[model samples]
Target: MFAALAWSLHAADAELRRALVPTSRYTPSELREGLCAALLARSSARRRRVVLEVTLIAGVNDELQHAHQLADFIAPIERACFDPRRKSGRTGVLINLIPYNPTYNRLAEGETVESRNDMSTLGIPHYSFFERPSWERIDAFQDALRARGVWVSVRASRGDADASACGQLATNRKLAAT
Candidate 1:
């Protein structure tokens, strides 16, 4: 069994992160530190693949600055996982960039507004609202990560019609709107 932490590391998008994951009290920095430690600990086992999953939203976590922050954050973890010193070293680290799985606007009863307000409580300009990112933007993000020598892949969206894929639920709603 592979050991992994599927964290939504929205580097600069802390508000969105907090909104999406309400269980965690850790800030973005704390999450990053904790994740790095976990990655190292998991890599020490030497029998599992260390995977870090980051959900990238169009205008939220897909910016160039966020990519740089991600690279810096994961560089050491990648090294720890891929080190060539130990007998069971070079286990490898895979970073999966999943685009945001959009959520439908449940505004029939003012729920959407309430949710928006909730997101705004974090002190940032509450802005989790996003659409699918452009192909160029995605490419730039991938390129930035790869430039840092990190193994990365843009996860393909699956089950869009049935809304099983990332962002498809919102996509479905958005489609209905248009």
Candidate 2:
């Protein structure tokens, strides 16, 4: 119950049981709508606008979903635009980046090349957070991506306190041990 409060988008439809979750799930838009509708059909809510934590192009599953199936998949949403014309509703998609954490990725920059490319291919509005894109090239990051309204939130390691945010929780372990 408390977890639901943290997410801004919630559905009041009793048959739809979607609660706000920290993690994300990505599938065809119709599937996402159907899933949400099923959840709403069962849950109780005074608020219908709930943030759906969905992965646009993040994990292994994100890679497997077919882009062409979005419209039929999201039919439960009725009028949800693949690319929304306006931002009036409380309902929004918290699009998480894929390949999970992009930090130790010695492979290609999945978020930039693959995920972003795929979302664009699907015409879905998305937001990305880079693990460690070279600071000098942020201009390229901003220009190539943000200008399109696909926001990229970079991780800031401002110091020890900021270390945890960078996924370096072990930094605290040494201090606690001493």
Candidate 3:
């Protein structure tokens, strides 16, 4: 389960998400509530663990407040997984925090191309404001989640040297093709 903007159900949150990830067609409510419900159902039925990956973008959704919202959002799902009434042993949700990698466009000119039409052709947007959170910030965010009893882990970046990081794949493909 990938939820880069999990707290984006409210009007302001949704606007922030739209600015960063305009290509996303699903509403924030659908992405948050609907996806959580589906994941909970699947985990209960299959008796398996679910891992939710959230990409942390600096000044976008990496604040401590967002961490609290995330904890609140996943609380019910986590409880459902560990409900004593359910015979499932240890099925639960784990959150993986992935710091945003500097993509090709970000590294190239330090500015995003604002043309939506151009971005549509490449199937990727150039997020000028997106940046990886500092180590201190990441740690604080992790601590906040842990304080709320939510299991969480910080993911290390891989393939970043080759522009194949999490949000860089599509842009890399387009550049390679060109």
Candidate 4:
């Protein structure tokens, strides 16, 4: 099982999270608390491995400072999930860094983009305002995490050209319909 934490709660603005994920009922703090509780609950023997995914969006939450915040936020959870008794000495926590995949606007034909709900009203720009970080930036982010001893990996970009990559499933369907 895996928990996709999208962005570091410590580094991201709470209002931005709510605006981006309007359907989610839990606030950032509540989500973090719940994740910790769930991790602790499963920390005992026969604990399951949980990979945390963080999609790095350029200019959004892909800075070096954000990496530090992410490391700090994950430290306690890593400890809670670590099992020394286990022969592998694994923490059972893996962080997967995914580069953002651009998606087309879901507007029907002839619909003006301006007709969509204004995300700026929530004090944050729309999701389209962000873009994928450069490859060098991604490497630097990974290096920062490794420097902090976090088990991290950058997910390779695949199937994006065919709209089958992460975050592209729905877009694939939309394209097919058109």
Candidate 5:
């Protein structure tokens, strides 16, 4: 629904070609391996056109730095990030990341994220912002991505207004029988 709406609004001026399935269910390795395998299998990727990515509702926090660690497994990036906490050493790639945040509350009216962005060299875009970013901040993120010479975007949800808050999508399947 949101995707369709976004298209309705910007389809003429937009170049959103690919999509990443949004979820953190897969471990970073699982995500990376799957993405790499898909890329390897694609003729377009061999031609260096399509880029794989980590989708919305999927990312690693400081504690779960799967995305951070996954970097070492992938090839070298062109310029690497400066932040010590984030993964290190990558300079360039044909495509970079610009993933989305899904754990949003109504409180998310105006906020932004700032990443060191060396990770972007991998052809996977990490939203410079994290966690329920606001529309106001999206432009800065766009500007940052533009500075990197990469296109930018915010992943949108297509179904279910009540589709649980990203990581907050938790439910106990088994209920105590009364």
Candidate 6:
């Protein structure tokens, strides 16, 4: 996604891409390797695009520091194709920050909604968690991203009234199970 902005359309995908982040599943080095591989994949004509998607759960990963860290991560890629003599303005990477939905809670065993647990259980041995981000937090985070020159956007809340959106699936299944 970052490198492809500078690549010709023929070398990239027509639609923007996506990738889940905070991949609690992998270590920092491993994450770096994954990003490098994606970049290499694009530059080498093996793939067209790669969009890094990170869900910002209100107080969890919505911190300004997270934005900075993300910016730092993609800075080098942004400069990779730059030419001082030419105005080769790059379109840059598209980062889609999705705020968590609370329709279905992924509480840990023995955990309850009143507990206010903000920790993530992803990639952990055996755990899951869920939370939602406030509109204010989302705005501020997007501003931070803009300051970093990163192309960032909040994934619009879709199908909220459908009762079948993300998180809600579990609830729907439970109701059916009953």
Per-candidate TM-scores read: 0.70, 0.29, 0.67, 0.75, 0.31, 0.60
Give a tens-digit lDDT track for model 4, residues 22-129: 776888667767776876776363374556678887776788987887787777677766777768666766778989887754567796546776576754445645
Please name the candidate that would achieve the greatest lDDT relative to the true structure. Answer: 4
Mark the regions of model 2 whose C-alpha exceeds 4 Å error after superposition: 1-34, 42-46, 52-130, 133-161, 166-168, 172-178
Model 4 sits at a Cα RMSD from the real structure of: 4.1
Model 4 bad stretches (over 4 Å): 1-13, 43-48, 86-89, 106-114, 121-125, 170-178
* The candidate that achieves the highest TM-score relative to the unseen native structure: 4
RMSD of each: 5.6, 12.2, 6.5, 4.1, 15.4, 8.7
TM-score of 5: 0.31
Total clashing pairs in model 1: 2
* Residue 109 shift from truth in candidate 5, angstroms: 28
* lDDT of candidate 5 over 1-178, digit per residue (tens): 1110011111110111121223234544454455445444545322322232423223222112332232333332212211233242222232223333343333223643222323344333453333543444444444544454443345454432454533345333536799
Q: How many residue pairs clash in each candidate?
A: 2, 24, 0, 0, 17, 1
- What lDDT does candidate 3 reach at residue 93? 68
Candidate 1 segments exceeding 4 Å error = 1-5, 12-16, 35-45, 85-91, 109-115, 118-128, 167-178
lDDT of 1 by residue, 54-107 (tens): 777676678888788877776666655665654633346677887666554445
User: Order the candidates by TM-score, highest first — what do you get?
Assistant: 4, 1, 3, 6, 5, 2
By summed lDDT, the worst window of 10 consecutive residues in model 1 runs over 169-178
lDDT by residue (tens digit), candidate 2, 1-178: 2223222222222121121122335323334565466546643432323233222223212322222132223234322322233354323222222122332223233435454323333333232332333444433433433343432333334443444332333332225455
Error of 4 at 19 (Å): 3.3
Clash pairs (backbone) in predicted model 6: 1-50
Q: Candidates' lDDT values, in order? A: 0.65, 0.31, 0.64, 0.70, 0.33, 0.52
Q: List the residue pairs that clash in candidate 4.
A: none
